[model samples]
Target: MAAVSLSVSTVKPLGDRIFIKVSEAEAKTAGGILLPDNAQEKPQVGEVTAVGPGKRSDDGTRQELDVKVGDKVLYSKYAGTEVKLAGEEYILLSEKDILAVVA
Candidate 1:
C-alpha cells in the first residue's frame, strides 16, 4: 500500500485500522544509564490518534471497535508499519494487533 502522507489534524484510519503516535523509545535505564541507539527496544506502546470505522462483519454490517482515539494501547512488538507524517512518528496497524488497552 502507498504510505499515507497526512497531518495529524486531518488523518483518519481507512478500515479496521488505527493511526498511532508511537511513544518515544526509552533512551535510558531505570538506573540512569544511557543506552545507545541500537540498544533501545522497539516501542510496543502508543496512544491511538485516529481509528477507522470498524471492520465489516460476515453479514456486511460494521462492528464497533473496542478502542477510540486517545486510548493507550500495547500491540505486538512488530505489528505495524512505521510511517512519518509532518515530522512526527506514527504506526498503522489493524485493531487485532493491539493486545490491550492501557486503562
Candidate 2:
C-alpha cells in the first residue's frame, strides 16, 4: 500500500463527526504539587478543529451541529478515538459525544 500523508487541514469529518485538538493535561495540582505523566487524567476539553456538515434526519433534512470550529468543548470521558497527527494529540468523535460547548 502506498503511504498517505495526513494533516489538520486535510481532514474533513462527515455526518456530524467532529475533530478536536486535545488540550494539554494539567501538570500541576491546585496545591502546587507536580503530578507525573502517569498520574495525569485524560483531558476532556479541547478546541474544535473540524466538523461535519450535519446529521441526516429521518425526512432527509440535514440537522446542523451546535458546535463549530474553534469552539472549546467538553466531551464525555472515554469517548472518541484518539489520534496523533504531526506529533499533536487529537480526537475524532460524534456530535453526541460532546457534552457542552465551553464559553
CA deviation > 4 Å runs, candidate 2: none
Clash pairs of candidate 2?
none
Clashes counted in candidate 1 amount to 0
lDDT of 2: 0.98
Lowest-lDDT window of 10 residues in candidate 2? 76-85
Locate the minimum summed-lDDT window of 10 residues in model 1. 3-12
Deviation in Å, model 2, residue 20 alpha carbon: 0.6
* C-alpha lDDT score of every prediction, in listed order: 0.91, 0.98
Q: Model 2: number of clashes?
A: 0
Q: Estimate the TM-score of every prediction.
A: 0.89, 0.98
Off by over 4 Å in 1: 1-5
**In angstroms, how far off is 74's CA in candidate 1?**
0.4
Best by lDDT: 2
Model 1 RMSD vs true structure: 2.8
